[model samples]
Target: MTSTARAAHPFITSHGLKAALADGEEIAVLDVRETGVYTHRHILFAASAPLWRLELLIDRLVPRRGTRIVLVDADETLAHQAAAKLVRLGWNQVSVLAGGTDAWAAEGFEIFSGTNVPSKAFGEIIEHRKHTPWIDADELQERVARGDKLVVVDSRTPEEFAQFSLPFAHSLPGAELVYRIQEIAPDPETLVVVNCAGRTRSIVGAQTLIDAGIPNRVVSLKDGTMAWLLAGRALAHGRHAALPEPGPATLATARDRAEVVARRAGVRLIDADELARFEAEAGERSLYRFDVRTEQEYVAGHLEGWRWVPGGQLVQATDEYVATRRSRIVLADWDGVRALTTAAWLAQLGGHEVFVHAPPALAPRVTGAEPVRVLPSRAAAPLVSPLQADALLNAGQAVAFDVDRRAAYERHHVAGARFAVPDRLQSFTAELPPTQTVLLVSPDGVLARIVAAELAARTHRDVRAIAGGTGAWAAAGLPTASGAEGVLTGDDDHWYSPYAHADHAARDAGFRAYLAWELGLVAQLEREGEVGIRLIPAA
Candidate 1:
C-alpha cells in the first residue's frame, strides 16, 4: 500500500473510492496513465489523462479545481506526480488512490477496458434500444456496383474523410447530417447511406435523418467501414467532396425538423437572458457553454466565452468536456439543427441540465476573445530565429527537432530537422548526434518551450526554442521536407478506428475487440448506476 504521509493531499483507499461511488457524490476520478495503458484497463468511470499532457489538459478536463479529484495509476509513480502538479496548480482537494489500480482491483470493482468505452457502449445501447436501421456492407457494395441512385455520406470530419472513405461518398460529419442531408440528396428516391470508421456516428447520423422525417431512405452502413473491408470491398482514398451549403428550402426543413426533435426530447430553447442567468450562477454550480459547430465555423466568429465543440465529438467524448457529472451545459450554434440535436442527446445521456441557446440570428456575432490556447507552464529559455537555427545546424553546433504531431511533420518540416516525440524525449536523447546546442521547433512556440525546459534540465548542452514555430519558419522561405524524418517514437496518441487499418487481420481483430467492448456496455451501465439515458424510440 502507498504511504499516506502527505496529508495536504491525502491518499484515498480503494474502499473510500467505492464509498464515494455508492454515495453518488460529485467527484472526478482520473486515470493518469498513457492512453495505451489506460485503454487496456482502468477503474470504471475514470477519465484518461497521461502524465505527459496532464498540466496542459487539466484545466479543460476539470475546470473547477476545488472539485474532489481522485487520481489513480496502475503503478504509484504517475499518480503521485499528477497529484503534486494539481496541488501546485491550486487544486485544494486532490487525492491519490492508495496502491493505485491494484488496490481497486483487490476490492473487486469492475475495471473497464477500451478507448471511448462510454461512447461506444452508449452507441451499442442506442442501437439495441432505439433499433436504428442499417444496410449490410455486401448490400451496399452490390448496389454501388449496379450503379444505384445512392448518396454515401461519411459522418467523419473532412480530414478523416480525406484520408479514406467509400467510393463516391461525400463528407457530412455528425450534427451536420440533419442540416445538410437535403442538399446532398435532393431527390427523395435517393438511397442515403451514412458511414463512419465504425458504428456510433453512422447510427447516430442515420437516426438523426430518420427522426427528422426525411423522405429519403437513410440507413447506416452496417458495422461501418470495417464491415466494408471485411466483405472484400475496396475503399476510396483521398476524397474531398464536402456537403454543399443548404439552400433556403433545405435550411427551413432543417429548422422545422430540429424543433420537432428538440420538443420530443424535452430540450429547452433559452434566450440570451436565461443564458446570462446560468452564467451568473457559476459560483454555485459549474456551467459549460459551447458552440456546437465546425472548428472553421467557430474560428470565423462565435459568442463570447462560447468555446467550439462539434456536436458529434461532444456527444462521443463527454468525459473530456464535462467532468462534473451534474453540471449545467448550454450549447449554441448558428443554426438550430446542431445545437438542438446535441442538446437532445446530452439530455438523454443524463446527469446534466442541458439547453439550447437560440440567438436572434444564425451567423455568429464577432464577440468574445479567442479560445484559450495552452502554453508552457514555466518560463521559456532564450529563443533563436529560424535563420539562426539554420546557421547553427550547418556548422554542426546544433540539432533541430520538430516537436509537432507526426502528420504535421510529414506535411512540411525544416529540411534537416528530425521528428521528435516529446513524450519519449528521455529515451530518444541518446540517439541524437553529439552537439553543443539543441533547438526545438513546434507548430507554435508553446510546445518547443515546454520541451526546451525539459532538455535544459536533463542535458549539459545549451537548449533553446525557435522564435515562432514551423509557420514562422515557412514564412521565412526556408527549404523544407515533405515527409517524416528520423521518427523516434511510435505514434500511439491517436487511436485510429478499426476500419481505418488496411491490414485485413488487424482490422478484423480491432472490430472484434470493439464489438466485444460495446457488447458489455449495458452491464457496465448497471454497475455505474448513475448514467442518465432515455432512448427516444424510433419514430
Candidate 2:
C-alpha cells in the first residue's frame, strides 16, 4: 500500500521566516531528514526530527500542537511529507519552507553544519561576552605536578566522564557546579577547573560558578579534552567519580548564592499557583515544565507532570528540549539551587520567559521513569513469542530483521537476523526471499510492530513482530550473533560524534575541526543578526 494521500500544506518563504524570527514570534523549525544527513547541512536553529521516528519524538520536541511549525529539509519533498504528517497529528499551524535549506542559503542566510548549533553558538557568545577564565593544558599539568590545592571537574554527563576524562578529574555535570561547588572546593583559595569534550560546557560550567559569586578561583580547561589530547596527554578512561550530594549546610549556602544569581539574571521565582496558571494556558501558549535535577534524584521522587531533564543537558541542548521558540519554561527541584542555576542561564539565553519553582512541602510525587508520548500506530501486526520465533527460524520458514540502532544491532541480535533501517525497509526487504515469513524486532517491540504492519500491507506477505523485541529474545536463552553480519544501510540514520571516529588520525582531525567550528560560532552569530541570544552581565 502507498502512503496515505495528504493535502498540500502552505509554504513559507525564507524572507517570511527571517522576519518572523526577528519579530520573536513563537515557532519551531524542524528538519525532517535523517540525523546523519541533517548534520551535513541544515538551518542554524532547526531541530532534528527524522521522518522515520517523527511519531516517537514530536511530542517531546514540539509539545504544543497549535504552535506554528516550519518544516525544512535539503529539498522541499521531505518537508512537505513531514508537514502532512504533522497536520494529521493535530498540528493546525504547519508549513514547509518554500525551498528548504537551499532557498535559505540562496537568500544569503547562514547555513550551519553541526548538531546543536544554537546551543554551541550560545556558549561561544557567553564566552565572548563574559570572558570566562581559562587555563591551558600545560598550566593545568604544571599546577597538578606542583601539588596545588585544586580540583579538576568534568562538566559533561556522568556517562561521558566515564568514557574519558582528565587525570583525577571529578564528574560534576555543568548545572551541579553551582549547586555543589562550595562542598567540592570549600577552601576559597583552592582552584576549580572545569572541562567537557570540547568548549561549550567547559565555558558554561566554569562561568556558572563565577556567576554564582563563588569565592574559589574558577577557570575552564582551554579546549577541554581535545586540547589535552593535542598536547599529547593521556586521558583516564572508565572513571566514574561523581561528587557526593551536598549536605544541608552546603545546600543552604548554594540556595542563597543561586537566588542572588538568578535575581541578577532576571529569572522570576514562581509559586505553585503561578505554575498552575501557566499550565492552564499551555494550550494557547507553549509551556515547558522541567525538573532540573540529576536523573537518580528525579527518579527517586519528582513533582508529578514535570519532565526530568538533567539541568546540564538542558542547557547544553536547549533546542532539543524546548523546540517551541519563545515558550514559557518552568524549572523545579527539591533544593532551589539546581532550578535557580539552570533558570539563570536560560533567562540569559533569551527568547523564552524562564521561571523557577520549588515543589510544595507535601506535593504529590511520581516515581520511576518519565512517561513518553508516542503517536498510535494505525495498525498492529501479529506478534510471535521468542520460542515461536526460534522454531520458525530453525525450520528456515522465517527471516528476522532488526530495526534498531546500528550499534545496538552490531552489539547483539538474533542469529541470522539482518539489520534494517526503518525508513529504508521497503527497498531493503525487496531483495529478501518472498516465501519466508518476515519477523521484525526493535529495542522494544513498539517500532517493530508499527513497521511490520506497514510492510505487510505493502508486500502482501506474512509479517510478524517479535514480542518484547531483542530483550525478550536474549532473556529466553536464544542464540544471538554479534558484528556486522548483515547491515543493509550503514550509519545512515545517526550522526557520529568526533570522538566516535575509529581511526586515531581521523578522530584527531575531527577534534580539531569541531573545536574550530565552536571558536568560529561567535563570528557567525554576528553575521546572522537577530538570532535571539542575549547575555546578562555576569554577577
Best by TM-score: 2
For model 2, the local distance difference test gives 0.85
Check candidate 1 and list the clashing pairs: none
Q: Candidate 1 residues 1-539, lDDT tens each?
A: 23456544578898888777556556778888766567777876688876656656777777776678889888676787777767767677888898888878877777787776666777777777878889999898789889999999998888888988887788998888888888879999999999997788888788878888999888999878877877777788988864688888889889999888878888888888888898887756678888888777777778866777788888878877777666778898567688988887787776678888876675347754455655354445779998898899899888888875676787888888888666566556656665668888987766787778766765655789898888888889988888645665545444545764558799789887886666678788777666567777666
Candidate 1: lDDT over CA atoms? 0.77
Model 2, span 1-539: residue lDDT tens: 01223436887889988877766768988898877788888888788887767778888888888999888998786787677778777888988888789999999998888878888998898889899999999999999999999999998999989989887898999888878877779899999999998999999998899888889999999999999988888999998765778899888889899899888888998888898899889999999999988888889998877899889889899988888888999998578888889998888888789988888889988899898777843466799999999999999998889986888888889888998777778786687789889999987777788778767877888899999999899999999899988988777666667787768788899889899988998898888887767677855
Shift in Å, residue 452, candidate 2: 3.0
Tally clashes: model 2.
1
TM-score of 2: 0.94
C-alpha positional error of residue 227 in candidate 2 after TM-score superposition, expressed in Å: 1.7
Distance from true location, Cα of 42 in model 2, Å = 0.5
The root-mean-square deviation over C-alpha atoms between each candidate and the true structure, in angstroms, is 3.5, 2.9
lDDT of each: 0.77, 0.85
> Can you list the residue pairs that collide in candidate 2?
1-458
